[model samples]
Target: MSANIEKLQQVISSYFGTSEPIDESTVAADIDGWDSLAHASLMIRVEEEFDVQFPMEAIWKLKNVGEMASLIAKLREGA
Candidate 1:
Protein backbone atom coordinates (compact mmCIF):
# COMPACT_ATOMS: atom_id res chain seq x y z
CA MET A 1 0.00 0.00 0.00
CA SER A 2 1.17 3.55 -0.65
CA ALA A 3 1.71 5.99 2.19
CA ASN A 4 -1.27 8.01 1.08
CA ILE A 5 -3.48 4.93 1.20
CA GLU A 6 -2.26 4.04 4.65
CA LYS A 7 -3.01 7.51 5.94
CA LEU A 8 -6.40 7.56 4.26
CA GLN A 9 -7.30 4.19 5.74
CA GLN A 10 -6.38 5.53 9.13
CA VAL A 11 -8.59 8.54 8.57
CA ILE A 12 -11.50 6.35 7.50
CA SER A 13 -10.99 3.98 10.39
CA SER A 14 -10.83 6.80 12.86
CA TYR A 15 -13.81 8.69 11.56
CA PHE A 16 -16.04 5.73 10.74
CA GLY A 17 -14.89 3.17 13.31
CA THR A 18 -14.18 0.66 10.56
CA SER A 19 -11.98 -2.13 11.84
CA GLU A 20 -11.57 -4.09 8.64
CA PRO A 21 -8.70 -3.44 6.28
CA ILE A 22 -9.41 -0.96 3.52
CA ASP A 23 -7.53 -0.90 0.23
CA GLU A 24 -7.27 0.93 -3.08
CA SER A 25 -10.62 -0.45 -4.23
CA THR A 26 -12.59 0.56 -1.16
CA VAL A 27 -15.41 2.98 -1.79
CA ALA A 28 -18.04 4.77 0.31
CA ALA A 29 -20.68 2.26 -0.69
CA ASP A 30 -18.54 -0.52 0.70
CA ILE A 31 -18.62 0.92 4.20
CA ASP A 32 -21.51 0.43 6.58
CA GLY A 33 -21.73 3.98 7.89
CA TRP A 34 -20.50 5.92 4.90
CA ASP A 35 -23.93 6.99 3.79
CA SER A 36 -24.77 10.22 2.04
CA LEU A 37 -25.16 11.97 5.39
CA ALA A 38 -21.61 11.15 6.37
CA HIS A 39 -20.03 11.70 3.00
CA ALA A 40 -19.37 15.40 3.34
CA SER A 41 -17.98 15.03 6.82
CA LEU A 42 -15.72 12.21 5.71
CA MET A 43 -14.39 14.30 2.86
CA ILE A 44 -13.74 17.16 5.24
CA ARG A 45 -11.82 14.87 7.54
CA VAL A 46 -9.85 13.41 4.64
CA GLU A 47 -8.89 16.85 3.40
CA GLU A 48 -7.87 17.82 6.91
CA GLU A 49 -5.77 14.70 7.30
CA PHE A 50 -3.96 15.29 4.00
CA ASP A 51 -3.78 19.02 4.56
CA VAL A 52 -5.06 19.62 1.07
CA GLN A 53 -8.35 20.96 -0.16
CA PHE A 54 -9.89 19.04 -3.02
CA PRO A 55 -11.32 20.93 -5.96
CA MET A 56 -15.10 20.67 -6.20
CA GLU A 57 -14.90 18.79 -9.48
CA ALA A 58 -12.22 16.46 -8.18
CA ILE A 59 -14.43 15.57 -5.26
CA TRP A 60 -17.01 14.14 -7.64
CA LYS A 61 -14.32 12.41 -9.63
CA LEU A 62 -12.99 10.36 -6.74
CA LYS A 63 -14.47 6.87 -7.17
CA ASN A 64 -12.24 4.92 -4.83
CA VAL A 65 -9.32 5.09 -2.45
CA GLY A 66 -6.76 4.81 -5.24
CA GLU A 67 -8.21 7.73 -7.13
CA MET A 68 -8.30 9.81 -4.03
CA ALA A 69 -4.68 8.99 -3.25
CA SER A 70 -3.72 9.79 -6.81
CA LEU A 71 -5.45 13.13 -6.65
CA ILE A 72 -3.71 13.90 -3.40
CA ALA A 73 -0.35 13.07 -4.93
CA LYS A 74 -1.08 15.16 -7.97
CA LEU A 75 -2.25 18.10 -5.90
CA ARG A 76 0.77 17.86 -3.63
CA GLU A 77 3.09 17.63 -6.59
CA GLY A 78 1.64 20.85 -7.92
CA ALA A 79 2.15 22.61 -4.61
Candidate 2:
Protein backbone atom coordinates (compact mmCIF):
# COMPACT_ATOMS: atom_id res chain seq x y z
CA MET A 1 0.00 0.00 0.00
CA SER A 2 1.09 3.55 -0.54
CA ALA A 3 2.18 5.55 2.52
CA ASN A 4 -0.85 7.77 2.04
CA ILE A 5 -3.18 4.78 1.97
CA GLU A 6 -1.59 3.38 5.11
CA LYS A 7 -1.93 6.68 6.88
CA LEU A 8 -5.52 6.99 5.77
CA GLN A 9 -6.38 3.57 7.14
CA GLN A 10 -4.55 4.36 10.35
CA VAL A 11 -6.53 7.49 10.86
CA ILE A 12 -9.78 5.69 10.15
CA SER A 13 -8.94 2.79 12.45
CA SER A 14 -7.92 5.15 15.18
CA TYR A 15 -11.15 7.07 14.82
CA PHE A 16 -13.18 3.89 15.03
CA GLY A 17 -11.02 2.26 17.69
CA THR A 18 -10.55 -0.77 15.52
CA SER A 19 -7.37 -2.75 14.86
CA GLU A 20 -8.79 -4.72 11.97
CA PRO A 21 -7.31 -3.75 8.66
CA ILE A 22 -9.34 -1.55 6.36
CA ASP A 23 -9.19 -1.99 2.60
CA GLU A 24 -10.49 -0.26 -0.49
CA SER A 25 -13.70 -2.27 -0.42
CA THR A 26 -14.43 -1.70 3.24
CA VAL A 27 -17.84 -0.12 3.57
CA ALA A 28 -18.54 2.71 5.97
CA ALA A 29 -21.53 0.85 7.45
CA ASP A 30 -19.23 -1.91 8.61
CA ILE A 31 -17.33 0.35 10.95
CA ASP A 32 -18.31 1.98 14.20
CA GLY A 33 -18.88 5.74 14.26
CA TRP A 34 -19.40 5.69 10.53
CA ASP A 35 -22.95 7.00 10.59
CA SER A 36 -24.07 10.26 9.03
CA LEU A 37 -22.57 12.51 11.68
CA ALA A 38 -19.30 10.64 11.88
CA HIS A 39 -19.25 10.46 8.14
CA ALA A 40 -19.20 14.23 8.00
CA SER A 41 -16.55 14.33 10.69
CA LEU A 42 -14.54 11.75 8.78
CA MET A 43 -14.65 13.90 5.67
CA ILE A 44 -13.52 16.90 7.65
CA ARG A 45 -10.73 14.89 9.24
CA VAL A 46 -9.64 13.66 5.84
CA GLU A 47 -9.61 17.16 4.44
CA GLU A 48 -7.55 18.44 7.33
CA GLU A 49 -5.17 15.52 7.21
CA PHE A 50 -4.67 15.70 3.46
CA ASP A 51 -4.74 19.49 3.37
CA VAL A 52 -7.49 19.53 0.81
CA GLN A 53 -11.18 20.34 0.84
CA PHE A 54 -13.86 18.34 -0.95
CA PRO A 55 -17.21 19.32 -2.34
CA MET A 56 -20.16 18.55 -0.07
CA GLU A 57 -21.98 16.77 -2.85
CA ALA A 58 -19.03 14.50 -3.46
CA ILE A 59 -18.55 13.80 0.20
CA TRP A 60 -22.06 12.34 0.38
CA LYS A 61 -21.21 9.89 -2.37
CA LEU A 62 -18.15 8.31 -0.79
CA LYS A 63 -19.46 4.89 0.27
CA ASN A 64 -16.23 2.98 0.58
CA VAL A 65 -12.54 3.40 1.19
CA GLY A 66 -11.68 3.16 -2.51
CA GLU A 67 -14.03 5.99 -3.43
CA MET A 68 -12.71 8.03 -0.56
CA ALA A 69 -9.11 7.43 -1.66
CA SER A 70 -9.90 8.39 -5.23
CA LEU A 71 -11.60 11.58 -4.08
CA ILE A 72 -8.75 12.38 -1.74
CA ALA A 73 -6.23 11.81 -4.53
CA LYS A 74 -8.16 14.08 -6.83
CA LEU A 75 -8.39 16.78 -4.19
CA ARG A 76 -4.70 16.48 -3.40
CA GLU A 77 -3.76 16.69 -7.05
CA GLY A 78 -6.03 19.67 -7.54
CA ALA A 79 -4.42 21.37 -4.59
Candidate 3:
Protein backbone atom coordinates (compact mmCIF):
# COMPACT_ATOMS: atom_id res chain seq x y z
CA MET A 1 0.00 0.00 0.00
CA SER A 2 2.80 2.40 0.82
CA ALA A 3 4.59 1.56 -2.40
CA ASN A 4 1.44 2.14 -4.39
CA ILE A 5 1.01 5.53 -2.83
CA GLU A 6 4.64 6.33 -3.56
CA LYS A 7 4.23 5.40 -7.22
CA LEU A 8 1.09 7.46 -7.49
CA GLN A 9 2.91 10.36 -5.90
CA GLN A 10 5.72 10.00 -8.42
CA VAL A 11 3.23 9.96 -11.29
CA ILE A 12 1.45 13.01 -9.98
CA SER A 13 4.73 14.83 -9.44
CA SER A 14 5.87 13.99 -12.92
CA TYR A 15 2.62 15.27 -14.39
CA PHE A 16 2.70 18.46 -12.40
CA GLY A 17 6.47 19.00 -12.88
CA THR A 18 7.35 19.04 -9.20
CA SER A 19 6.46 17.48 -5.90
CA GLU A 20 4.08 20.07 -4.66
CA PRO A 21 2.96 18.31 -1.52
CA ILE A 22 -0.15 16.24 -2.20
CA ASP A 23 -2.19 13.57 -0.49
CA GLU A 24 -5.69 12.11 -0.65
CA SER A 25 -6.80 15.46 0.64
CA THR A 26 -5.30 17.44 -2.20
CA VAL A 27 -8.26 18.33 -4.38
CA ALA A 28 -8.15 19.27 -8.04
CA ALA A 29 -9.69 22.62 -7.21
CA ASP A 30 -6.99 23.17 -4.62
CA ILE A 31 -4.08 22.49 -6.93
CA ASP A 32 -2.96 25.62 -8.77
CA GLY A 33 -2.12 23.92 -12.07
CA TRP A 34 -4.90 21.39 -12.25
CA ASP A 35 -6.99 22.02 -15.35
CA SER A 36 -8.90 19.89 -17.83
CA LEU A 37 -5.91 19.19 -20.03
CA ALA A 38 -3.71 18.38 -17.06
CA HIS A 39 -6.46 16.21 -15.70
CA ALA A 40 -6.58 14.31 -18.97
CA SER A 41 -2.83 13.93 -18.90
CA LEU A 42 -3.01 12.66 -15.34
CA MET A 43 -5.59 10.06 -16.33
CA ILE A 44 -3.39 8.86 -19.14
CA ARG A 45 -0.35 8.62 -16.89
CA VAL A 46 -2.31 6.83 -14.20
CA GLU A 47 -3.77 4.37 -16.69
CA GLU A 48 -0.34 3.59 -18.06
CA GLU A 49 1.20 3.22 -14.64
CA PHE A 50 -1.51 1.03 -13.15
CA ASP A 51 -2.31 -1.03 -16.24
CA VAL A 52 -6.01 -0.32 -15.92
CA GLN A 53 -8.62 1.81 -17.61
CA PHE A 54 -10.80 4.10 -15.62
CA PRO A 55 -14.32 5.04 -16.59
CA MET A 56 -15.06 8.63 -17.51
CA GLU A 57 -17.09 9.04 -14.36
CA ALA A 58 -14.24 7.78 -12.25
CA ILE A 59 -11.88 10.18 -13.92
CA TRP A 60 -14.23 13.04 -13.25
CA LYS A 61 -14.82 12.01 -9.67
CA LEU A 62 -11.19 11.81 -8.60
CA LYS A 63 -10.63 14.70 -6.24
CA ASN A 64 -7.28 14.20 -4.51
CA VAL A 65 -4.22 11.97 -4.16
CA GLY A 66 -5.94 9.72 -1.62
CA GLU A 67 -8.96 9.31 -3.84
CA MET A 68 -6.75 8.56 -6.80
CA ALA A 69 -4.95 5.93 -4.76
CA SER A 70 -8.25 4.35 -3.81
CA LEU A 71 -9.41 4.37 -7.40
CA ILE A 72 -6.19 2.76 -8.53
CA ALA A 73 -6.60 0.05 -5.92
CA LYS A 74 -10.14 -0.64 -7.05
CA LEU A 75 -9.13 -0.79 -10.70
CA ARG A 76 -6.21 -3.05 -9.86
CA GLU A 77 -8.55 -5.38 -8.06
CA GLY A 78 -10.91 -5.53 -11.05
CA ALA A 79 -8.02 -6.09 -13.40
Candidate 4:
Protein backbone atom coordinates (compact mmCIF):
# COMPACT_ATOMS: atom_id res chain seq x y z
CA MET A 1 0.00 0.00 0.00
CA SER A 2 1.05 3.58 -0.61
CA ALA A 3 2.01 5.62 2.43
CA ASN A 4 -1.12 7.64 1.79
CA ILE A 5 -3.29 4.57 1.99
CA GLU A 6 -1.52 3.24 5.05
CA LYS A 7 -1.98 6.49 6.85
CA LEU A 8 -5.55 6.78 5.62
CA GLN A 9 -6.29 3.38 7.06
CA GLN A 10 -4.67 4.38 10.29
CA VAL A 11 -6.78 7.46 10.57
CA ILE A 12 -9.96 5.55 9.85
CA SER A 13 -9.05 2.70 12.13
CA SER A 14 -8.33 5.12 14.91
CA TYR A 15 -11.57 6.96 14.32
CA PHE A 16 -13.70 3.86 14.50
CA GLY A 17 -11.64 2.32 17.29
CA THR A 18 -11.29 -0.81 15.28
CA SER A 19 -8.45 -3.00 14.14
CA GLU A 20 -10.54 -4.44 11.32
CA PRO A 21 -8.84 -4.03 8.00
CA ILE A 22 -10.35 -1.39 5.79
CA ASP A 23 -9.80 -1.63 2.08
CA GLU A 24 -10.79 0.31 -1.03
CA SER A 25 -14.09 -1.52 -1.06
CA THR A 26 -14.96 -0.75 2.54
CA VAL A 27 -18.17 1.20 2.91
CA ALA A 28 -20.08 2.72 5.82
CA ALA A 29 -22.06 -0.43 6.38
CA ASP A 30 -18.95 -2.44 7.00
CA ILE A 31 -18.21 -0.57 10.18
CA ASP A 32 -20.24 -0.17 13.29
CA GLY A 33 -21.51 3.31 14.26
CA TRP A 34 -20.92 4.60 10.77
CA ASP A 35 -24.09 6.55 10.39
CA SER A 36 -24.68 9.80 8.54
CA LEU A 37 -23.35 11.96 11.36
CA ALA A 38 -20.28 9.78 11.76
CA HIS A 39 -19.62 10.17 8.07
CA ALA A 40 -19.48 13.96 8.38
CA SER A 41 -17.08 13.84 11.31
CA LEU A 42 -14.95 11.24 9.64
CA MET A 43 -14.60 13.41 6.58
CA ILE A 44 -13.48 16.30 8.73
CA ARG A 45 -10.91 14.03 10.34
CA VAL A 46 -9.71 13.02 6.89
CA GLU A 47 -9.32 16.63 5.82
CA GLU A 48 -7.41 17.39 8.98
CA GLU A 49 -5.14 14.39 8.65
CA PHE A 50 -4.28 15.27 5.05
CA ASP A 51 -4.26 19.01 5.71
CA VAL A 52 -6.43 19.43 2.64
CA GLN A 53 -9.86 20.89 2.52
CA PHE A 54 -12.54 18.91 0.75
CA PRO A 55 -14.78 20.88 -1.57
CA MET A 56 -18.41 20.86 -0.48
CA GLU A 57 -19.52 19.37 -3.77
CA ALA A 58 -16.88 16.69 -3.70
CA ILE A 59 -17.52 15.71 -0.12
CA TRP A 60 -20.86 14.20 -0.90
CA LYS A 61 -19.47 12.48 -3.95
CA LEU A 62 -17.05 10.33 -1.99
CA LYS A 63 -18.62 6.88 -2.31
CA ASN A 64 -16.00 4.71 -0.63
CA VAL A 65 -12.60 4.56 1.01
CA GLY A 66 -10.86 4.30 -2.36
CA GLU A 67 -12.41 7.52 -3.60
CA MET A 68 -11.47 9.26 -0.37
CA ALA A 69 -7.90 8.07 -0.64
CA SER A 70 -7.77 9.11 -4.29
CA LEU A 71 -9.00 12.59 -3.50
CA ILE A 72 -6.47 12.96 -0.73
CA ALA A 73 -3.72 11.76 -2.99
CA LYS A 74 -4.70 14.20 -5.71
CA LEU A 75 -4.89 17.09 -3.30
CA ARG A 76 -1.47 16.28 -1.94
CA GLU A 77 -0.05 16.10 -5.43
CA GLY A 78 -1.50 19.50 -6.32
CA ALA A 79 -0.08 20.96 -3.15
TM-score head-to-head 3 vs 4, winner: 4
Candidate 2 is scored at a TM of 0.89
Which residue runs does candidate 3 get wrong by more than 4 Å? none
lDDT-wise, the better of 1 and 4 is 1
Q: Write the per-residue lDDT of candidate 2 for residues 1-79, one digit (tens) a residue.
A: 6666777898899888988779888888888668988888877888888888889799888778888888888878877
Candidate 4, pairs of clashing residues: none
- Candidate 3 root-mean-square deviation in Å: 1.6
Per-residue lDDT, model 4, residue 1, is: 71
Give the number of colliding residue pairs in candidate 3: 1
Any idea what lDDT model 3 has?
Answer: 0.80
For candidate 4, write residues 1-79 as lDDT tens digits.
Answer: 7777788889999999988889888888888887888988998998998999988899888888888899998988898
TM-score ranking from best to worst?
Answer: 1, 4, 2, 3
Error of 3 at 77 (Å): 1.1
For model 1, the stretches where C-alpha displacement exceeds 4 angstroms are none
lDDT of 3 at 42: 80
Instruction: In candidate 1, list every pair of residues with a backbone clash.
Output: none
Model 2: weakest 10-residue lDDT segment is: 1-10
> How close is every model to the real structure, measured as TM-score?
0.92, 0.89, 0.84, 0.91
Write model 3 residue lDDT over 1-79, tens digit each, in one string. 4666889878887777866876667777666688877899888988999898988888887767788888888888887
The whole-model C-alpha lDDT of candidate 4 against the native structure comes to 0.87
How does each model score on lDDT? 0.88, 0.83, 0.80, 0.87
